[model samples]
Target: MTASTANDQRFREFKMPDVGEGLTEAEILKWYVQPGDTVTDGQVVCEVETAKAAVELPIPYDGVVHELNFGEGVTVDVGTVIISVDTDPGAGPVAPAAAPAAEAPAAPAAPEEDEEPQGRQAVLVGYGAAPSSTKRRPRRQQPGVPAQPAALQAELNGHAAPAAAPAPAAPVAAPAPAPASVASAPAAGRPLAKPPVRKLAKDLGIDLATVAPTGPEGIITREDVYAAAAPAPAPAVAVPAAVAPAPVPAVVSADRERRVPVKGVRKATAQAMVASAFTAPHVTEFITVDVTRTMKLVQELKQDPDMAGLRVNPLLLVAKAFLIAIRRHPDVNAAWDEANQEIVYKDYINLGIAAATPRGLIVPNIKDAGTKTLPQLATELAELVSTAREGKTSPAAMSGGTVTITNVGVFGVDTGTPILVCRRVLLRHPW
Candidate 1:
């Protein structure tokens, strides 16, 4: 349903733009607009989570949305057309065929058919559809038929298939008597177990009729299947004179280990670390200073009316000290531009504070930290920590950092070699 150049000249395809530094793709996390929805220039149509951060993409031109090319959770490549917007507002009702049939549902007839096209039937994506409850139709089991193929049975059993044997002359053995605790299964009725419990019972080779149900309304549960599969304890009269051995832990073997695709923040962090490690010549320098007075100052500031309701910690003083050092030696606050063969001396300090969140190590900087007072800096630091923790730190917060200060002390490390964050001078502090 994506707008093709051959389809209509008025239908402009909006390509997925790179929202971060050299990010090649992003996962469409959520869509805010749908087909036939009226959108204006600069209106946010969708939110995409890239390798670096989550960004809301805005449509550049005012138009009626035609179709979205990809579904949510789809990692679309940069420069790929994700959505098509029809510039003509007077265009007729978007044909159900215009959108993917799987996504757009048929509209019910009503007096206001004109209104239905705009509000109901025109949604061209599954994400926009209202939730519908579904029930599974009962599968009838056939007699004298194996549930699985013979090849699959051999593979699951971990053995080669044997040659077919002659039919038994008589009944081999009588069926085991139904236990008093076990309930009898209803005639021609499916087992009263949930899908997961049924799967567990199948894997354990336990029959539902052999398991006594403890769950409400005679429904078989996972615990019931496990109890039925478990070996019964020996009676005192049946036991040998020797002591009973302890139960051994079962060993589990898997055919294959689960593999999670490396993408998003984790992937970006890996690439950045590798590039920085190879390209930047890292120099490690350690300095031990007496922070006895600094600790006392932080305590004093906490009680001060100026620092009321602000996070007054040793990190605040440490950040301020780094800023003063940068001011003392202004030349170090510069970057070597390899492409231009020039040193770019920056006048302002965009201090980067390294934060470890659930996503990855993100260095969101305080813009113009040098211009802020102690209270202002503390406030900014508190906000930055909160934003990073919520995974809502913007790309702008991570960009334009001239110097980075990583407090490894928070991680209980005394000292560590911090990787250069994209050519910036890194300062690591271990408590």
Candidate 2:
């Protein structure tokens, strides 16, 4: 259906473009169009979420949307064909696809948990999308058709005119711009939020597309989102509908929680955390070093003629201090290999610092912290901070930590017991 009829009217299927500006890819959150629906170039077709934001995909061709390749929540590479548009290359092409109806059904009660996945028919990748609506909306005007509302038809062209005098000299043809098309193209329905807010949502992996728009012109503003956060225990009320339901609402608990099944990065984090917590008999000691001493060293280093532009920071000192402390407490940094039945004490300090991410807490250690110069450590620290904050930290950078010093002092309220993995014995999988 997306095929263009004119030989020269080539159909250009717009894959999900990287609208995030130099960002890599996005998750295909949902598609608005299916086969047989009309679409116009520049119309929004699907919604995608990246590591940094959620965005709407504008259809690139004026045609029938032939297929939707990806379903909700399946992340596809940028430039991937999530939808194909069919069109006639001629000046007057077919009308664009109509807007989709609400994706949710009107059910008062939640369905049983185990059955939800089995009931939903996923798109190509089997990524789950919101439930489909059984009902359809009324048809709207199509391309090459009038955009005028149906009610205005009684006073339309020629109905009130006299047919005499050669039909009144066949009223002189006047030129006017064609009416604007209705977007309704299988809408991914991301409420409008500007690029920066979108970026924030993407960074948080928040689905702005479904959040209620409280801003003017039905846009989802950043403030709206912040309010939506904070108290996260509540499942959002189903999006408002035209035929409003008349039931009294129940106030649910304000607990921030979601029971995600153990898998992927989370599963790995759990195993690693548990291992680090119990295996090593974690004896976390805290000494709030008036990091004043380290802070003074940083200032001195910054002013040094040789260290100009080295971008000195307190973390550099912490790394140095950790290495210094390691000389005395090398025992704190060793790992036990259960299978080999050996105590693995690493001589080289692969000093690892841990940070929190949208995925989970990740501990990426500095490679050979013992060998790098002050400048090198500063550079590595900057690179690591930037990459980890951007959620692009590599896995290899995370493993094989001899010992680690976590800067909880940076959190302002310092001093706490830290847990290290306890390896009960060489035989029991490093509990």
Candidate 3:
């Protein structure tokens, strides 16, 4: 044998190490490496899906994956072992089993409280760490503190989340807004200030709607909210509730094997849904949202001339609400930062809407949606659904979706925890 080939030890390989940011499992969103691809340690080798967003995962060691336990879109619980790297076992001492660095994450921000669709927070290693043991943790309750609503907690984290104000939201359409809308405040079109600015407005009781938008395209961003609300304004008196939520209905269907047509969008929806549901571990929690203002706003938008002839449904409000909430709660717009073995928060929103098309159930995101108005959202939803129905939607439109709303109501069903689609959605716009 030649001297180079004599050292067969150079072909030594390794299994996928648990990224160890408390990740118990992960969904293979996309592979950055394969059996044939050579990669160095700490290189962004793949994108993994967690409960909240798609995260780029890095190879912890230098090598190639000789084997993978599951294919793309498969959920892998932490420590279960995946991907054997084929490289020199003596590769300068592969540091397996070393915990993630503490300095890597001091905790990224969380999503809007509502953006948490299905609950589990820490399913994949490097997203939210799983509980140490399967045995349930004892419930510790303190006196005088009202019990947190189940909706306030992440199903994955198994811990109650903090409370959040309800903000109206809707889906955006098209590629990201022009760069002008991503940065500073402008009298015309700018991204406006960041989410922090909006929170300041909320705390000070400033109405974003009334602020003369100085942002790009005259959009009001978080910074404008702050500038408008710097002086604590008086709270607007909340209108009395004129309606209440209907009772929850039983999910058990009386008819089994009912002939639901297998035509068009249903087929596509079925395939994607099945892939997402069975492959990813799901933990969903529901909340009976009381969006009285949302209903009121719909009424107001109807009378406004500028919003004439637009589709304004409760779903639109939900989208808008998500955006508003994200301004104050951006954690929802994030994903597992697996390469860093941590959760990475995003500042933007790629709003997703689930459409039941003649081709199947499809979800297309409205990119850079964090800055649109209600009228714009309504128009986007209209176009999104129309595109899905015609099967004219591009793959790009179907990808990069952040959070999603199934709109089960269209099918005469209430909200349901949707299964992960090739895993799950993205960003800090969680709800």
Winner on TM-score between 1 and 3 is: 1
- TM-score of each candidate? 0.57, 0.41, 0.36
Locate the minimum summed-lDDT window of 10 residues in model 1: 129-138
* Candidate lDDT (C-alpha), each: 0.80, 0.62, 0.62
- How high is the lDDT of residue 292 in model 2? 66
Model 1 ranges with Cα > 4 A deviation: 1-10, 34-42, 60-64, 86-90, 93-256, 340-343
Worst 10 residues of 3 by lDDT: 422-431
**What would the per-residue lDDT of candidate 3 be over residues 23-86, giving only the tens digit for each residue?**
3555676776767677788887666643323356666667665556568867777556556666
Per-residue alpha-carbon lDDT of candidate 2 for residues 1-431, written as tens digits (9 for 90 to 100): 43333422444566777664454666776677787788876888876655433456687578776567777767678777777665653445544555568788666565554344444554665365544432334455444554453334424521344333432333434556555334322236646788988887777667886577777666678887776654658776886687777889776665655666544345556776786665555443333346567678888999987677667877677677667776677665666677898887767788766666665666677888887877888888878777777766654566555666555555665355555533421110000
Over all chains combined, what TM-score does candidate 1 have?
A: 0.57
Off by over 4 Å in 2: 1-264, 288-291, 327-331, 421-431
Q: What lDDT tens digits, residue by residue, belong to model 1 across residues 372-421?
A: 89989999999999998988888888788988888887767778888888
Pick out the ten consecutive residues of candidate 2 with the lowest summed lDDT. 422-431
